[model samples]
Target: MRKLILLVAMLAMVLVGSVPALAQSTLSGDQGANPPESDGGSVRGIITDISGSVVLVEADPSASSGPKGYFTVTDETEIARLEGDIRIRASFEDLEVGQQVQADYAGPIAESYPPQGEAGSIVILDEGGETDREATLSFELEVECDPPANAAFFGFIPAEGGINAQLTDPDEDGVYTGSVNVPKFPPGPAPPGTEPVSLPVQIVQVRGVIKDFGEVKIDGDKTFKATVSFCDDNGGGSGNGGSSSGGGKTLPNTGGVLPITLGAGALLVAGGLLARRLGR
Candidate 1:
């Protein structure tokens, strides 16, 4: 009886050791190199390391069981920074280590240790240690653009291109509202000795009507304008070259996982960089 009891205990230990593998296979439903192709998925977290072209992201602790992931970003992988309604093109160099990011990819997330996946697009979700020269411009405006299909709104710096935000259709009819993000940019050089008061944004509201008259007709467009102020997030007013945080600081090189926050900005895949327009 003593010998049998000892044998049963040994078998229980082996079963416990093998439980994880069995669970993984059951969870993945496939135990090969690829688990199974996911329609598409997104991983939001902070970048911990950048080796060659692979970016190591530390998943948020709130994540079910995923801890860290390796994303392979390539030249073809689209990188964009959200500024108001526009998504500006960003290079790999723009992806500083320790910055918060969201990588959208296809294919099944690898089941291997330190799970890996191929990144199709990576977005800089947080300013992290971006310079003081940049600020975030967030705004919401009321407009009279009717028929959502014939109206568009833009927030720009005039001579230099900025960002664009799209208007939403009204459930109440004829009224449109939108929120935009303009990030990491100064209002421009301040006049000598003059505090950079406010940004003179060319708020262009374009209204157009498409006329398909026997296929030989063209559409006519009319432009309208307004002015608004954008301030930095770091307690600096719209005056004096907007305030910035994390200045003179560099990204982290720590070897630990990180956290992520998302769902506040727009993911514009509407063509390349937001069309550079002045609502003109």
Candidate 2:
């Protein structure tokens, strides 16, 4: 009968070509439908100024339904791995100043910028790009006395010194940042009194070691200030500590009595000049 009408018009063109791949696998449930002409290149903003590696985002031009441009994030460690706590998500969580953001970006497409300045634009979830390969150590700190406003400034982890993390300044305006992960700093000079002498690192798992430092607290005052940096695998930098403009210095909680009181006053002035040269 004409082969049953040619198998019913070849099963109605294979069910209309499987209805757009089963409606794109049921709206990407299993992942398979991101192409309505797919742009995948976006950037919606409102982050006005961030200094030190520069970040001045302010383009919400109506949160783009599509098409509209003007971007700049120039990689400050990818904008601190996409704003982890940048003064509390870009200024006290309200995230205002024209609140709005959307970013996807691919990479490399400069017209006139790109010296060390180029994240191009990727503000989607506000910031995303840190698979946790583990290795982060950022820096900046300043506070020469005056820390008791609420008390909460502790950071020190140069591979066993301990206490690695706890800092705040979400625009309270005192200057203190964050980052941590330790277990590597064996190049030299870090075991003597240990107050940040020098540490610049970027090495993963050879024994860890990711440090980003800061310290400060002021409202009533009790003394506080610190700034440090280190990242293992050999490739990171920053260092500084108490006294020398960092203020705050009083240490000496016993033991070794201030170098044994300067070695017993230099052995009583060298035994009274050797008993006056054996009594002349």
Q: Pick the candidate with the highest lDDT.
A: 1
Cα TM-score of candidate 2? 0.18
Model 1 has an lDDT value of: 0.49
After superposition, which runs of candidate 2 have C-alpha atoms over 4 Å from their true positions? 1-172, 180-270, 277-280
Q: List residue ranges in candidate 1 displaced over 4 A.
A: 1-40, 61-67, 107-109, 127-280
Look at candidate 2 and tell me the lDDT of residue 271: 100
Best by TM-score: 1
**Candidate 1: worst-modelled 10 consecutive residues by lDDT:** 209-218
**Cα lDDT computed for each candidate against the true fold:** 0.49, 0.40
lDDT of 2 by residue, 135-207 (tens): 3444345533444333344444434344345555687666665556542223343332122223322211111
- Alpha carbon lDDT at 176, candidate 1: 39
lDDT of 2 at 69: 34
Model 1 per-residue lDDT tens digits across residues 23-80: 9878776545443322246667788889988887766544434556778886678887
